[model samples]
Target chain A: MQFLRTVLTIARKDLVIEARSRELAYTTLFFAISVVLVFSFSFVVEGVALTDAAAGILWVAIAFAGTLALGRTFERERQADTLKALLLSPVERPAIYLGKLVGLLLLMTVVEALIVPVVGLLFQAPLGRAPWLLTGLLAAGTLGFAAVGTLFAAMLIRAHSRDVLLPVVLYPITVPLVIAGVRGTASIFAAEPNLAMAQAWLSMLVFFDAVFLTLALWVFGPVMSE
Target chain B: MVSVDDVSRNYGRRRALARVTLQAARGEVLGLFGPNGAGKSTLISVLSTLLRPSSGRVRYGTHTADGAGDALRGHIGVLGHDLFLYGDLSARENLAFFGRLYGLDDLDARVTDALRLARLSDRADDRAGSFSRGLRQRLALERALLHQPRLVLLDEPFTGLDDDSALVLIERLRSLRERGTIVVMATHDFDTAEAVVDRAICVDRGRAWPVAAGAGTLRERYRRTLKERG
Candidate 1:
């Protein structure tokens, strides 16, 4: 119960800061929309079919945009060395990771909420057909992405080249989630959506999220300490 | 009581602290004075459990920092060079956030009292980003003391404070000492050290020794120590 309270307190603190600044949400949303628009324009083919292109574009936009959000989120903690202050607190390190993951998830979810419709409108894809499945895939993929992303972001808070290093390190490890997300999203966006294939990809996403989140939780304390 | 036994810390090839031993009892204010790279802040970091000693250990009574882990941190309040308060949050919100993190009961009351203590009650609703450096330092002090920690670590607490504000802070440190809170302050300001410290030590080149007795003043003792070492 105390752990949960700590998690909520941290999450609330991040959310409150974001709410006041509106920096992360606005920047992430704008970046996501921009990515979608650029991709939509580029992926147009005169004769070639664009069946799976929409799924690829949507997931790529989210992945890229999510990185932006993660950077900014950790940037706030880095300012004034607030992350060190948080580390000095009695709260469990896993709780801190979980709290940051939830905050990132929420911010990414808001970006998706805005970007999904834009993707649909621009790509002429039917994202509204299976709203629930799409939500599950997005949630599962984002959880996995954030679980690992938060750890690396914190680990690199003091790194000299953190901005360049974050994506360089993050993208390789998150390949499985991206592959699963793109495949699952492509399956859902199929003319006659393949439920079984989508479910399989979703399962892969869920498994990766669980394994990485537990690993992240276990390593956070030691990695964060001197 | 807090006991640091031969604590030494290093970063890469540079040694920050070397075989430094110190102790502070309840109701005592221990001042650590040193030159720019003298490792006073390093020792404070070790005591605060933010940095682990490369060799040796620190003990709070019978429990070591390794054994106590997060629980040890609960009893510590640190005001380092970094303010630690979020600039976007109002002063009240920053206090309330830290109050909840410390799991204090009746949080609203505690936050109210903290704001009043920092003399920031009038500007409690304003964002910390808008405050002057002295005001920010005051609010940071309030945040550190929100839970009434047993051990308070202040690193250059007077960095941005005006003379009047510094005196106000000194009085507060005295009050904490009277309340049996152990205070360890690291600063270059010898005057503040002379004003409040029960005992002062001059640390140089990673080693520490007590400021000599019968010395003219902290400033004189410190200069003499540095000259002798040279």
Candidate 2:
């Protein structure tokens, strides 16, 4: 019960800060929109081609924008040495990781909400056919991304070139999630959406999230410890 | 009581703290005076469990840092060089947030007391980003004390304070000592050290030894040590 309270406190703090500033949400949304627009113009050889490429473009945009959000999210903690302060508290380290993961997931979900419709409009992708499945796939893939991303962001918080290093360290480890996300999303955008294939990819994403989240929780204490 | 035993910390080839040992009992204000790069902050970090020593151990009463773990941390309150309050949050929000983290039972009342203690009640609703350096330092100190910790560590607490603000802080330190809170403060300012500290230790080249007299004597000793090391 205390653990859950601590997690909620941390998540609430981040959300409150984000709600007031809206810095990460606004910037990430704008960046995702820009990425989608650029891809639509560059990749659309014809209407059919645009629809086919939509999944890749949408996921890639989320990946790029999600990375930015993760960096900025940790950057707030880094600015006033707030992360160190958080570390000094008696709360469990994994709780901190979980809280950050939830915050990142929420921010990424908002960006995805905005991006999916924009992608649908611009590329003529079939987003309405399988709304629930699409949401599930996005959630699963983003959970994996945030699980690993939060860990690396905390690890590199004090590194000299953290901004440059975050993406470099993050992308390689999360490639499997991205692959699963793109495949799952592609299936959803198909003329007759392959629910089974998307489900398989979704299952893979869930597995990845569970395994990586456990690993992150296990390693957070030692990595964050001085 | 808090005890540091033969603690040594190193970063690569550079040694930050040598096998330094010290002890502080309740109702005492122990001042750590050192020149820059003399490992005062590093030693304080170890005491606060923010840094693990490369060798040696820290004990709070009978329990070691590892053994005590979260319980030990719960009794420690630290105000370091960085103001740990989030700039975007209002002063009241920052204190309330940390009070909840410390699991304080009466969070609203505790936060109110903390705000009054820091003299930040008037500006409690304003964003911390708008606070002056001195106000921020005061707020940080308040945050450290909100949990009613038994052991308080302040690293260069007087760095940015004006004379008036410094006096207000000194009074609070004196009150903490009177209440039997073990206070360890790291600073180079002899005047401030002489004002509040019950005993002083001068550290140089990663080692520490007690100063024989008050701030004036300690100042001379520190210069002599620096000259000898050069």
Candidate 3:
């Protein structure tokens, strides 16, 4: 019970800061929209998007924007050494990690809510097709991506040139997540929609989320100790 | 009681703290005096368990850091150079947030008392970023003490404070000492520290030496002691 309260407290603190500064929201959202627009030009040839390009473009925007959000979130903590303060507090490290993960999930949900519709409008994809499966895949995939991202971002708080290092270290590790998200999203939005294939990919994403979340929770304590 | 036994810390080939040993009983204030690279901050970090001694151990009562873990940290409040404050949050919100993090009871009353201690009651709703450095430092001190930790480790608490603000801090430290909280402070501000520090030790080249009596002043002792040690 105390652990849960601690987690919520941390998340609430982040949200309050973000709500006031709007740094992450403004920058990440603008960057995400820019990514979608730039891709629309390349992927949509003369007003018609390539058959399978929207899924790739949509996932790419999310991946890039998620990285930006992850970097910025930890950057706030690093700016004033607040992360050290949080670490110094007498709470379970996993609770801290879960709190950060939950906050990121919510922020990313907002970004996707805005970006997904924009992607659909621009690329002429049917976003409403198999909505529940799409939501599951999005949730599981975001969880997997954010779980690994939060751990890495926290670990890199003291490292030099962390901005450049974040993407360099993050992209390679998140390959499976992006791939599953893209394929799952692709199958659901395919010309002749493959709901079964989407379900299979969603299952794979769920498995990935569970694995990543567990590993991240276990690793956070020792890694953050120093 | 806090005991640090022959603690030595090294970063790569650079020795930061060399076989340093010290102990402070409850209600005592130990001042660490040093020049730029004398390892005062390093010693404080070791005491706070933020960094491990490359070769020694610290014990809080009967328990080591490994055994106590979060329980050990629960009783330690640190005010490092970083301040550990969110510039975007209001003074009241900052205190409230840390209060919740520590799971303190009657959070509103505690936060109100803390805000009063910081003397920011009038500006409680003001963002910390907009406050002057002295104001931030005071708020940070109160933030560290919000949990009422048994051991308070302060790294240069007097930095960036004006005379009046420093006096407020000195008075607060005196009260903390009266409350039987063990405070270990690392500061170059000998005059201000002299007002509150019960015992003073000079650390030079990563080695610690207790300042003897018959001193001209802490600054004089610090200079003469380092020269003699050299």
Q: lDDT winner among the candidates?
A: 3
Angstrom error at residue B133, model 3: 0.3
Report residue B98 deviation for candidate 1 (angstroms).
Answer: 0.3
Better of 1 and 3 by TM-score: 3
* DockQ-sorted candidate list, best first: 2, 1, 3
Give the per-residue lDDT of model 2 (tens digit) for B1-230: 99989999999899999999999999999999877888999998999998999999899999988887887899999998998999999999999999888889989988899899999899999999999999999999999999989999999999889998889999999999999999999987878667898888878879988776434465786676556654
TM-score of each: 0.98, 0.97, 0.98
Give lDDT tens digits, candidate 3, residues B1-230. 99999999999999999999989999999999988888999998888888888998899989998889988898999998998999999999999998888889999999999999999999999999999888999999999999999999999999999999999999999999999999999999999899899999889989998886674987787778778888
lDDT of 3 at A123: 95
Q: What is the TM-score ranking, best to worst?
A: 3, 1, 2
lDDT for B43 (candidate 2): 93
Q: How far is A185's C-alpha from truth in model 2 (Å)?
A: 1.1
Clashing pairs in 2: none
Which residue pairs come into collision in candidate 1? none
What does candidate 3's lDDT look like per residue over A141-224, in tens digits?
999999999999999999999999999998998999999999999998888999999999999999989899999999999998
Q: How accurate is candidate 3 locally (lDDT)?
A: 0.92
Q: Could you report the DockQ of all the candidates, in the order they appear?
A: 0.88, 0.89, 0.84
Report how far off residue B224 is in candidate 2 (Å): 4.4
